[model samples]
Target: MFRQTHIRLTFINSIVFIVLISILGSIIYFYTDNKLYEDVNQSLLKSVDHYQNTDGPEDSQGGKLGEGDQAPKFMGRDPRILTLIWDENGNLLAGENRGTMIFQGNEKLIRPKKYGTLEDVQVEDFSFRYVAFKTELPQVGKITVQVIRNVNSEKELLDRLLLIILIGCGVGIICAVASGYFLAGRALVPIKKSWQKQQQFVSDASHELRTPLAVIQAKTDLLFRAPQATIQEKILDVSTISKESRRLSKLVTNLLTLARSDSDQLEMKKSTFQLDELLKEILQQYEEIAMYQEKTLRLEAPEPVAFLADKERFHQLIVILLDNAIKYTKEGGDILLSCTQSHSSISLKVEDTGIGIPEKDIPKIFDRFYQSDKARTEAEGTGLGLSIAKWIIDKHHGKIKVHSIVGQGTKIEITFPKSQK
Candidate 1:
C-alpha cells in the first residue's frame, strides 16, 4: 500500500509539471507561427504588385514573353505563387483554381490595419491561407487580387514538433519517479538504525536489573531455610539484601530519567538565579562527600554572577560532574569548580586531578550507555549521567566541551549565553 501511495503521488506531481511545460511550449510555438505568417504575407504582397505592374498578358499565362518583353520582379528568390483576381461582377477573371474559390461573406482585406495572420479556409478539397491586396491596373481598373498558399505541409511539421516535446516530458517523469523512490529509502535508513538501537537498549537493561533482583531473592531464600541460623549471619544476609535492593532502585531511576528525557517529557521550572551562589551551594554539598573519600574540593567564582535558567536541572548537572570527579579521583586528589563571565557569555569549568580519560574514548563520553573502563569498574552508575547533563545543557541553549590527557586529568567546560536572561 505504501509503495502504491508513493507512486501515485510521484505520478501526479509529474503530470502537473508536464502540463505546465506543455503550456509554455504552446505559447512559444504560437508566437513563432505569428511571426512566420507576417513575413510570408509581406513577401506575397510585394510579388503580386510587381506582377501586375510590369508583366504583359503572356507572362501572366505562365509562359515566356516575345521580343522586347518585360518580366515581373518578385521580392524573394524561389517564390511559390498562388494568385486570384476578380472582376466587378464578382466573377473570377484570371487565377489558378478559379472555380473552387469559395468567398465567405463579402470579406475585404484592408492595408496596414491587420496584425495577426489570416485563418485557414478549405477550397476544392485543399486548405489554404490567403493574403488579399487591392490594386489599380492601368488598363483593367479596380482589380481585387488575392494571394493564397497551401499550409498543409507546415501544419504537419508543427504536429511532429509537439510529439517530440511530449516524448521528452514522458522520459523526464520516469526519471523523477525513480529518483524520488531512492531518496526516500536513503532518508529512512537512519530511522531504522535508531529503532534497532532502542531494541538493544531494552535487552541490556533487563539483564542488568535481573542480576541484583536474583541476589535479593537468593539471600531471602537462605534466611527462610536456616531458621536457627546465627544472629551475625542473619544480619549479614539482611545487609546484602538491602544494598542490592538500593542498587536496583538506583538503576531503575536512571533508566526512567533517560526515557523521559528522550521523550521530551521532562519539565523544568525556569527562573532567574545567581549562578555564583548556586555553584557555592553545590560545592558545599560535594565537599562533605569529598571529605569522606579523602578528596579535596575547591571553588572559584566571580562575585554575584547571575543567570536566568532552570535551577533544579542546573543543580543536577553540577551534581553529575562532581560525582564523576569523586568516583575517579584517587585519595587526596583535588577537584576545582569555577565560573567565569565574558563579554556575551559565561563559562563554567569543572577540573579534577584524577585518573584521566583516553583520547579515543573522549568523543563518545556523553553518549548513552557509555562508560570508561576505570569509571565502570570503580563506581555504581547506569552510564546515563553525562548523557543527561548534555541534554539539559542543550535545552538551556548552551554548549559543553571536554579536554583530557591520560594519567594527568580531565576538564569539562560549559558555556552559556549571557543574553539568555
Candidate 2:
C-alpha cells in the first residue's frame, strides 16, 4: 500500500512539473518569435520609406517609374531585402535587388492584386515576409511598393528553441520522479512502524484471550461431565473455572482501555489531592500481599505534597508499579515506594530489590503485550500493566523512566508538576 502511494505521489509531481514547464516554454517561444518578426518588419519599413522619398523619371513601360533614380542609401540595410514596383495597370515596371529574387514565381506574385497588406509568401522553396504600399514620387506616376525579407534564419531559431524546451521538460520530469519517490519513502517510515505495531497488538491479544477461554471451556466441560465426582473435586473444578473467567475479563478490560487510548478517547478527571495520603493508602493496601509473598515493603514519603492528577488513574498507576515490584522480588527482598517534592515538581520512585529486567528488554517494557522471558515464566499477567501505567502518566502530562541491573534491582521514577493551591 505504501508503495502504491509513493508511485501516485511521484506521478502527481511529474504532471505538475510538466505543466509548469510547458507554460513557461510557450511564453518564451511566442515572445522570441514576435521580437524576431518585429526586427524584420522595421528593416523592411525603413528601406521602403527611402525608395518612396526618391525623385525619379517617368517611363513608357505601362506609365511606370524607372530605375536609376538616386534613392538615398540606408546605413546597415539588410542584404536579404527584395524590392519590386508595379504600375496602376497591374504591370511589373521596376525592381531593386533583382538578382536576389532567385526563387521561381517571384515575378508573378508582384501585382496590384497582391498589394496593400503584409503577408507571408512561399515561392518554390523560398519563404518571404512582404508588405505592399501605394506611393507617388516626384515627376513619376503612382506605383505600388512591395518589400520582402527572408525568414529562414528566424524559422531555424524557433525550431531550436522548441527542441531546447522539450529537452528541459524531459529532464525536469525525470528529476521530479526520482526525488519524489525518495521523499515519499522517508515520509512513510513512521507510518509503517505504527502499522506493524497495530498488527502485532491484534495477534497478541487474540492469542492471550484464546488461552483463558480454552481453559474455561475445558474446566466447565469437566465439571458438567463428571457428575459422579467427589464434592471437593467438583469445587476445585469450579474454582478453576472462576479463575480463568476473571483472568479473561481482566484481559478484555485492558484491551479495551488500550483501544480507547489509541483513539484519543481516554478521559481523565483531574483534581488536586494530597500525594502523601494517597501513597500511604496504596502501600497499606499492598502490605498483606507483600507479606504473603514473603517480601519487605516500605514507603519513604515524609513531607505531604499536593498534585493535580486523575485521582483514580494515579492510584491505579501506583498499584501497577507496586504489584510488579512485589511479584518480581525474591523472598526477604526489599521493595521501596518513595515520593519527594521541590518548588515546582513532584518526583515518585518505586525501587525494588527484585529479579531485575535485562538491559536489552528495558526499552520495550511499556510496549503493549511485550513481556520478557522471565516475566512470562514467573508472573501471571497479561503484560499490559506497565503499558497502562505509561498511558496514565502520559495523560497526567508526566514523565516516567526505568533503571535496572539484572539480578540486582530495578528503579522506576516518575515526575509531575506540583499543583498550585
Highest lDDT among the candidates is held by which one?
Answer: 2
Compared with the true structure, all predictions reach lDDT values of: 0.71, 0.79
Local lDDT at 61 for model 1: 39
Model 2: CA > 4 A from native: 1-10, 13-162, 228-233, 342-344, 375-377, 417-421
State the lDDT of candidate 1 residue by residue for 2-53, as single tens digits.
4665566566665666677668777867876676566666666565555556
TM-score of 1: 0.69
Put down candidate 2 lDDT per residue, 3-90, tens digits, no spaces: 8987887777667767887788889999999998888988877766665565532222313243554321112245667565556675
lDDT of 2 at 399: 88
